[model samples]
Target chain A: MKKFINAVDNVLGESLDGFAAAHADLVTLGAERKFVRRRELNRSKVALISGGGSGHEPLHAGFVGHGMLDAACPGQVFTSPTPDQIVEAAQAVAGDAGVLFIVKNYAGDRMNFEMAAEIAEGRTATIVTDDDVAVEKSTYSIGRRGVAGTLIVEKIVGAAAEKGADLATCVALGERVNARTRSMGVALTSCTVPAAGTPTFALGEDEMEMGVGIHGEPGRRRVKLAQADAIASEMTTAIADDLAAPAGSEALLLVNGFGGTPTIELYLMYNAARRMLEQRGLRIARSLVGSYVTSLDMAGCSLTVSLLDAETTALWDAPVRTAALKW
Target chain B: MKKFINAVDNVLGESLDGFAAAHADLVTLGAERKFVRRRELNRSKVALISGGGSGHEPLHAGFVGHGMLDAACPGQVFTSPTPDQIVEAAQAVAGDAGVLFIVKNYAGDRMNFEMAAEIAEGRTATIVTDDDVAVEKSTYSIGRRGVAGTLIVEKIVGAAAEKGADLATCVALGERVNARTRSMGVALTSCTVPAAGTPTFALGEDEMEMGVGIHGEPGRRRVKLAQADAIASEMTTAIADDLAAPAGSEALLLVNGFGGTPTIELYLMYNAARRMLEQRGLRIARSLVGSYVTSLDMAGCSLTVSLLDAETTALWDAPVRTAALKW
Candidate 1:
């Protein structure tokens, strides 16, 4: 309840207004509300569009700019964006090259973005990512919940689109990247929704939840909080096993903070994960450790491993000028 | 206390290990134990060296790249780095032009950095920044405490050094930037130190501390938490009146989150501040909004405004490659 929001009901509109105001030079509000697009949208390039709930800041919106998503449709907290917002953003940024929709494998998100692509102008393709390795089902989705791997997919696919790849090419790359990546998360505490004015769920003072979803829903199970190294080992091993990456294979180990974790903690988690990977003979190629993905003030962290070859690695290192992921 | 650290005493070393490991492509651990330096050290340019307590991630180490600090020495959590660490960093990164030491206005930090500069090889200049407008003195600092403004000073001075400015020129520019910047902060909750294993202070559920320091020390006073607009108005007006920012002047707005605060709240605070600045007729020419500076797990935010002329704005806009701040 101590959040810095003006009102529970207006969190979405006001937060978006603040976002547009702060990043005026980089992005703008689409003709339709809840839609954010790059200010310097190029009508000739393949427009990349992706979005979901509102609590995960800098996800879709912060990723909008040169060499990234052309637009993002941010819904209310822990809610899927409406199709109208996506359709408007798609039409605004669509060109002769067409558009591609990047959807996380959530029922509402999949249905909404899919419907938007159906009605939107020009050719379109949808690549649904279900990267979470924690569980096969959650409260909001029948399949795995897409977590931090979506960011890696966005970066790789966004780079391809920037290089004048066609809509089909972008979709192929997104799916390829998604197949090579996996993510898992743990929650130390549940995040309270502003509208609810209370935690989404409750846990004992000494207890923690593993395999937690981004929306503060129940994870695999609630258990006693373990030491950092133990927690790190569990999460890292889960992600590494899920990838089944071959020996000597390189990867981009992404240690994403699930909002509310400090940078110091994220770095410590990185250390624990690195030790595990090194011992397993998996070549630690590149790494990004920070809160790139989050679950609104939830005190926990997640790990994602994107197996990288020369092509994907090059795209990952390609110059990107977005508010969040920039190299 | 809930944190991601492996051990209380090992927090500094393990985190530094992870930082070096994660950004090995751009930085390396100086032969000395805790010093972090750019991998591409240029011998012909003036070297910018900074360090302090370890909790503030993405400050000194994350800024060690193309257009920022050449090296940084991180101490144990919430403690000033030793003189040996700073001296080693200064010696390692020193170029033909010599080294410039950027010191925050904390007793331990100032003394250690000053001592290091005295012993380090080659010419050395120390510029202490005291831009915290919250108070003239604090528990740890004799004069003003250097808060988020230190990030601005480093960015501006580092850019000046990259353009081959002399050591004196870089020092003068850093001091000028410091003089033109001011900051203030508010905390809704206290941060618990990993070693201490307890919150620094306690407040009622509805209370907040204004003009709080980054270390979670006592501020001016505690009062009931206000709405986002009222809080923003108080903090923004305090900084604006302190700077005496001209009605038509252009300035860079830095909205920083203190580790645990969510991005939505930071944006809400940003929106409120933007309105106040526009009412005062100050143009926000540039803004770097994110959790660039932080206190571990503290639920609060701080604002830094740097009054920029044409020259400073260009320097601020200059391209710099680092793990945290870029472009």
Candidate 2:
């Protein structure tokens, strides 16, 4: 539960200032509080924008350059950015070619972004990403909670946008990536939010919760901490079965460490998933192992796989320039 | 520490298989033991090959893609990969262009990679990447420990190579990045290597060690847990003072969480560092806040900074395509 900051209220704004300072070439801050694209208005090219809460480091923001998003609006710690902020980011990054907002499936994100889209009615385009497969237990709950799988959607759609794909094409591509990708997570130790200054949830040392939401929401079930292979089997079975990416079909695997899981655990999970897929006759054409998207400092990891095609693979391999990610 | 894997012994091989599966367009694997470049060997470009222990997830391997390395050899768990494996990776990826070796500053990495380079001497070119700024206790000590700073060197040199900069230019650029970058780390809880199945070191809950090495080596000092802002101040002071980046000069800040620190903590630390730098009249031009490079599930983090010029900034912005890094 330890943290470093002068004041809890100023953390996000201060961090953004530091981010802008470090990535001046790729990003610039708008007085309106959005990260504006550094390249002068590429009116000829469609702009891509994505954003949400701040706990997921490098999710919407680290992806804001070159082959990915044109701009990103970071919210306060684990809180959605205001609709006004998103509207400002959308309008600022948009041009004659229009802008695409890649909103995650989360209710807060969806509602805020939808409101932003309304605010930008005449200014930009919007594309919602609903890639998470973990459904809510209650009918009153919002649809599936978007998790790390949204990243694959962002990358693909971002590439399409970079290639001068029209807003429609970009939106369609985003949808395709979402349909083909699925993610599920498990948490070992609940992380504490600095502002809240307490653990988000209570998790015993020997227990883990499966089907976790990115923002520390309760998962499908809590079970005894099992071996790496068992956990991988559990997460991967859910993903593979959902996508129906049977053996022989190529898939790209991403083992994401929730803020606190070590690379060692991620690798172990990756290995177990690979073995399980091999046994299932699935051929993994590529894999990403690390903290691509994270949930603050929660001690856990997630498995995300995007069933790939020639086009998806090409887009996935396309070059990109971002703060956390580089070839 | 909680981990994800079927078995300790199979972690490396399985993860490599998964990586190859996920990034087939960017990389290919040799029979059982080697990873090769997917880009048709541009005989004019120098092929850079690097590898060492497996725990440093993105280092040697995650960097292998356009604008960085040509191939990365994988070793078992935290142990060094064999010379034979490195030689094969080099031969498989090298063309008439020759190859470069980007080894860490560790004795194991240095000795193993050197032997591999020697083995491939007749057929390929090789260069060592020992960019870590942490110093050994004495010259009598084995070697300077390479840490996160090496990633900066890789990106710089890799971009140079992609731009058709030859071996000499790549080496010069690598060294420049090295000279401009410095990193120091601290650990809160000792990392428990899965293979070791126990904490790497002992520490009370309220204690931390600064100047900690990536591989869980004991640090220069162990002290009581300090506030996040205080920790960031201590780390940034060492890095800023070491580089002597003028108090008001533009600085690139990296608030890196060790394997287990939450994003909340990183953000808090980032806010502290930014304020501290600003108070000292330093201008943060850009900042990266996350776990770019990580140790095992060690509950701590490090701070890295590089004073950048136009060239460094350009390199930082160049597009890269790799498994761990994209865009």
Candidate 3:
């Protein structure tokens, strides 16, 4: 595979080092590169920690800052971080208010974060996210795998935590946000893993994998390639149907790229997805279109819809500062 | 080619529609989709206008908003916009302080913008950028091909314009910034133009084009793929040599992806570029890394270095609120 990496074994370390250096004003790397944490921590505010495999960048690590994650433990690509990494991160960032772990619904990640919480100090809680409606079970997940909607959960809950909410309040907010959000993805091409030096899976040029997972896992089905409008229709229908929000409910639409998609196509997808949601009588009160949660260099995009209440909408508008996101 | 597009001809229109929808608070589209202008124009400030081919997104259009371009016209993919489009844009956004056009140094773009400036009303000035050090002349350019450094020119000069710089002052500052900046790119894979339905150019599995242009034009030479550090070294040396800033000079290093490269690789490149800059005795006082200027979905990146003085540094730090960039 053609990639801008020095060595397969050193990809994560070098990239993390570059990330920490480039965003030094916003985040700091944990000892031994186990995690990334906010440069300045508020002692009275509850700390929000989230992490998963490393490929989905700008997710856990890029979200660490004033109005997002306090600490993010990054595992190797598509692999779970060890419990020790999570424990050390919690020990480094946990404050008087307490600590909350935002874990994706993957078996390895769930187990590691659970073990870390059990061994770490302070009042800790876990909010597991399973917002992907793509499938009920996947290669590494028992239920729906957490996908791009995880960004929404982290963003809204992170705002609440930034406002000095208690650990219980943060946990409740996170779970509520996750429940209101749904996501589905379509992959035009499989991503190459550095270590593997090959695409995760083979996809014919004229075909696409619908409802694909973030790890390039098998989705609902592989179908002949369709136009952007059709793909948007299928993905949006899956999300809106699963959300089951009342007609005229306000929502936030996110068109996320799987690393390799360009901004123009993402915006085009957003237009198609927005039209589909409007047809369902959902008001697109807010919208985000870009590659925030990516799956390496996979050529695809994901559509996420989160039913928004007044509180959630207000939180989503709150100020934030971090690498990959700032306002 | 696999792309998220409904029809080749509608890509620009649909994407612009979505962009206007997503950033309604910041920008508005002109009639007939001719240009994208700031939603709230400041009549007291000199208006900054820029336009070029559509494929290099977020360059001209995404930079339109507060503290940046007042209006931007997008042409067809890899093709220059018509003079009528540029004239109409200037007419729509020109304020009492007049308009200053920021044109990339391409044959078509320069010719079109020049014609627009002649036909456009009110006091107007133009600043042309030719920062690429790859080739003295290329397929579409007479001098060096303007590349990623155009963004730095827009940003620094835009900040000055927002601060109420006169039309003449804005032009002079833009020219100065453009003079101080230099860039070089490398492409690992070719991007497919929708209308063409094929890659712009082909490279063997083990080959790469160094000092490539944003449009996948032939570069300095084709060479065997090298490690990230070696590639960074070659690109950084070419830029640093052309820039020729005094030792200990303050500089802004920008690592821009050519659409398809992931954030991990971009940041890693940033690190490599940073080290090279330091080795040359330049202090990296400011850094911007991301896919701001892209070549559709080409898998590669460019390195841009701009010498920064006190005035330019302060201006670069000024607030900007746009779709692709916000602070």
lDDT for B267 in candidate 1 is 82
- Rank order (by lDDT, best first): 3, 1, 2
Query: Going through the candidates in order, what is chain B's TM-score?
Result: 0.97, 0.91, 0.98
Q: Write the per-residue lDDT of candidate 1 for residues A81-161, one digit (tens) a residue.
A: 998989888878889998888988888899999888778878888988889988854554487888889999999999989
Best candidate (score: lDDT) = 3
Greater DockQ among 1 and 3 belongs to: 3
What's the candidate order when arranged by decreasing TM-score?
3, 1, 2
Tens-digit per-residue lDDT, A241-310, candidate 2 = 7778756888888888888787656765776787787677777777777776888778888888788899
DockQ, candidate no. 2: 0.40
lDDT for predicted candidate 1 compared with the true structure: 0.86
The DockQ ranking, best first, is 3, 1, 2
Off by over 4 Å in 3: A137-141, B137-141
| TM per prediction | 0.97, 0.83, 0.98
Weakest ten-residue segment in model 3 chain A by summed lDDT: A135-144
What's the residue-level lDDT of A127 in candidate 3?
A: 92
Displacement of the residue A51 alpha carbon in candidate 1, Å: 1.1
> Across the candidates, what are chain A's individual TM-scores?
0.97, 0.95, 0.98
